[model samples]
Structure formats: C-alpha cells, structure tokens
Target: MITKPQFKSNDYKNGLYLVATPIGNLKDISFRSLEVLAKSDYILCEDTRVSKNLLEKYQIKSKLISNHKFNEKKNTLQIIEYLKSGKLISLISDAGTPSISDPGLVLVNECIRNNLNIFSIPGPSAVTTAVAASGFSDKFLFYGFLPEKKNQIEDEIKKLSNFNHCLVFFSSSKKLNKLIPAFKKFFTGRKIVFCRELSKLYEEYIRKNIDELELFNNELKGELTIVISEKKEEKASQKLSESDINLIKRMINKLTTKEITDLICTNKNIPKKVVYNFCLKLKNEI
Candidate 1:
C-alpha cells in the first residue's frame, strides 16, 4: 500500500521494482511504471531488445540486461550484488506482469530471500484485463496456461466445468481449435469469450457458445485468452445412496469390473477413483 510521493522519474531508487508492462497496447502502462523504469539504475528484461523498444518509445534512458528463463539463475546473483551496492533495479517482461506465466519469479524470490525491498508498479495483466471485460462473475478461476497433453487438458477442463464460476486460460492459436471441442464436451451449453490481442487495435472479444465456437474455421491468430462461463449448477459430488447404486447396477449387470466402475461413475457424476474403490469393496463382499 505504499504510495509514490510524486510522478517524477528520480523519485524511485535503490530497491527492486517489479514493473507491469502492457499486455498488448503499450499505452496501457501506468505512470508509476514509467517513473520506475526511468529512475532505476538498470532494467532486467526477458529480452533487452524488447524492453529497448518500450524505453525508446517512452523516451526513457536506462541500462538494459537480459534475464530470461535460460539465464535467470546465473544472472540473479549479479543483480543481487548490484542491489547490494544500493543500485535501483527494475524487472519487466516482454508483455504483461513479470512472474505471472512469465520470467521474473526466480529473481524476485532471490530478492525476497536476500531481504531486499520489492515494490510492484501495477499496470495491465491479460488475465485480469480479459476477466474484467468478460461479462462473467469475478469469482472465476485462472489457469495460466492450458495443459499440453490432450488427456490432461480434458481432465482439467472437466474439473473446471464442475465449478460455478467462469474459467480463464491462455492458449496459442494452434491449440484453440483443439480446445473448443473439449470445452463443448464438458461445458456443453456454456458461453465462451475468446479475447484476442487485448488492448491492441485489433483487440476483439469473440463471444459464442462452446458448441458454436467449434465450427469456426482454422487459421485463427493472435495471442488468445479463452474464457468459458460456468456450467449450470448441479448437485455436489457425494457418496451415492443405495438407490443410486441399484440404478447403476441395472445398466451394468453382468458387466466386467471396469464396466461396472465406469457406469457407476457416470451415474453418480463422481470421480472414477471413488467409484472404482467402492466397486472393489463390493467385489470383495461377493
């Protein structure tokens, strides 16, 4: 809750500043972020060239150092030594906030362990920016990036579908085509918002049902954030009653243990593990 006393660049000094840059539109940056960058002794960036473009645009002159994932571990010590000399330092990612699905966590953690002061100059974040304009409840869950494996993705989406709030995640344009179908399978009738190139001139929020979104042609492009509305409320998952078990047995009679387990799980809308373990106990009794 510390407040900057003034908007002057020289006002900031001698500590680690975690500055938030624009996710898309460069103008989305805050005054404080600019001041911190301008005043810092040097800036640690995911890419020095990318940070240089932003600095040149703003007419701010500061030393630049590359601190991406590959070099972050080794560079952290050097940055800390600079800070130990009472030099003001700032960290920025290519886009959005640092350490949020981006590079910055290691150096920040090191700074924390070294007992150095770290301050945040808030600006744009694709997750919150998309969520704010999503027309969905604020209680939504944010999964920074979708799982890469198809089975893992499906399971994760299925778990999120059971929740009662919106879900947000980042995906490449390549994965978007594959993701929509899975969303339809799990969430069915829910609405989705595909926020592309947010805050930039080409920014667009394409709202459609997951089923309908699946019909969109391939070659969709841009950095994408997919927001899916929660499914209609259903009864919570709990142990099934005897009546429920009887209904499942009717559908799976004389079926193998695997078949019985699957039918019982679908009937009770519970996790397969729970149903499988229960079916194992029933087999032991017989």
Candidate 2:
C-alpha cells in the first residue's frame, strides 16, 4: 500500500529542547528542528554569533542565550529557573547536536534533577556523516577531541587501539597532521579516511592506509573528522607437529632462540609468538 506523509504543526511543551543544527550547509537542518527553534522562548547556544547565521537564514527571530563550556555551569541554575517557570527553551551547539562535544549537558542534567521536561531534535552529526562515507565498519567510537599534551594523546590512542571497531576523532588540520605519526604507529595495517570540510563546498575525503599516511605540507583549514577502519584480525596459528618439534629441538642448541623462532615462522604460516614460545620452552628445559 502506498501512503503519503502528512505534516502537522508543532505544539511545543515548556521545557528544555536539545536541538541539532547543521554542521556546515545551512539547508541540512530538519524542518522539525526549525519549528522547535521558532517556537522556543529562548535558545541556548555555545556561541550566539555562530547560531545567528543559521537563525537569520531561516528568518527565525528566537532569542539566544550564550552557553559555552566556560559559562555553562554558571548559566545552568538560571536556565533551570527559566524551564521551571514553564518557558520553552531550546539548546543548540554552534554546529551539530547539542551536548555532543559542546555545551548543554550541565543544563540537561539540571533539568533532570529538577524533574523538568526535555526534548530531542536530532539532525546532523559529523561523526555519523564521516563514518558512513568512510566505507569503514559502522560500529564506531567517537572520541571527540584528542588531548593537548603529547603523552596524554599517546595514552589515549593506546587505549583506543584495543578496540576492534572503527574509531572516529575530531581534530584541526594542524593537529591532525601532528597526529598522523601516532596513528601510523598504533593503528598499523588499518585503513583511514580523513573527512575535511564535510558537507561544505570544499568538502574532501582523503583515504589512505595507515602506513601510507603522510603529513600535509600545506596547512588545511577547518576541522577534520578522522575515521580509522577496524583492526585486521590475525590468522589463527597452526599447531606445531612432531616434525616441527623435532626441528626446533635440533636447532635449539645450534642456533639462537630468536634465529630458530624467526626461521620457523618464516618457513610456515605460524605466529611469531607461538614459535618463540616453543623455542623458549625447549631452551628452558635444557
């Protein structure tokens, strides 16, 4: 059966509304998101200057409140009071969904503590956009931004390397260039995609193997969404046979343990660790 979708006017409730704005293109916003913003008594945003462009484009006249990381905590109490007063308030980031690597969580939590109503106006997301286009595994982990310190960044990458699912990260071009070395060192044998200026006119997707990635000589502008493909699973090691054991026993005394392990692994499709362990066991028994 064929059916036509019907549009209905929005009847907003007085509470906090987490609205999602376009990441790049102004027209990428949903109609429902606009309706919610239009009906909102006040819109809390990370940056009023950035949100202004979007509002002005849609001819939306909703008042905006500046709420960023620095001031979000201080603004939470006042905002909660507004929600308690039965005022319809909306929260939006400079781009993408609110509270996603942006301001809005503190206010949302305050609203929850106050038992206030909250609504979600989902729309665009750089994470999903990059992952979808990267041709990587859909299962992903979005680590918003890498730490500033080099050691912290390495530690973070080391932890993330243990996961088998695709990994997504947000970084500026300069920072991304600095991160390429770390990515190559930790994420070897994996594929990577760099999504630049996503959804914008100069949008670009650079795909490369981790080993082939090199630093950009020219400084690229705008934020980058990096998606690394899942770790490649290793082939199972074959069990050592009686003939293989005898060969290792014969070579254990004549050749060094490392040489024997290397020779056995190179001759057969076996894991180096497995061969190394057997050689170490025989040497220990001697």
Which candidate achieves the best TM-score against the true structure? 2
Residue-level lDDT of model 2, residues 77-180, one tens digit each, is 88888888889999999889889888888888888888999999889999999999999898999999999888888899999999999999999887877688
Score candidate 1 by TM-score against the native.
Answer: 0.76
Instruction: Provide the clashing-pair count of each candidate structure.
Output: 0, 0
lDDT tens digits, residue span 1-286, model 1:
4343355645765799999998877778888788888888889999887788788878788899888999989999999999999999999999998988888899889999999989988888899888889887888888888888889989988888778888989988887777776888888878889999888888899988777765557666866988877666655576877876776556444777788777666645677776667667666766
Question: Which one is best on lDDT?
Answer: 2
Can you tell me which runs of candidate 2 are displaced by over 4 Å?
Answer: 1-10, 237-286
Give the clashing residue pairs of candidate 2, or none: none
CA-lDDT, candidates in order: 0.82, 0.88
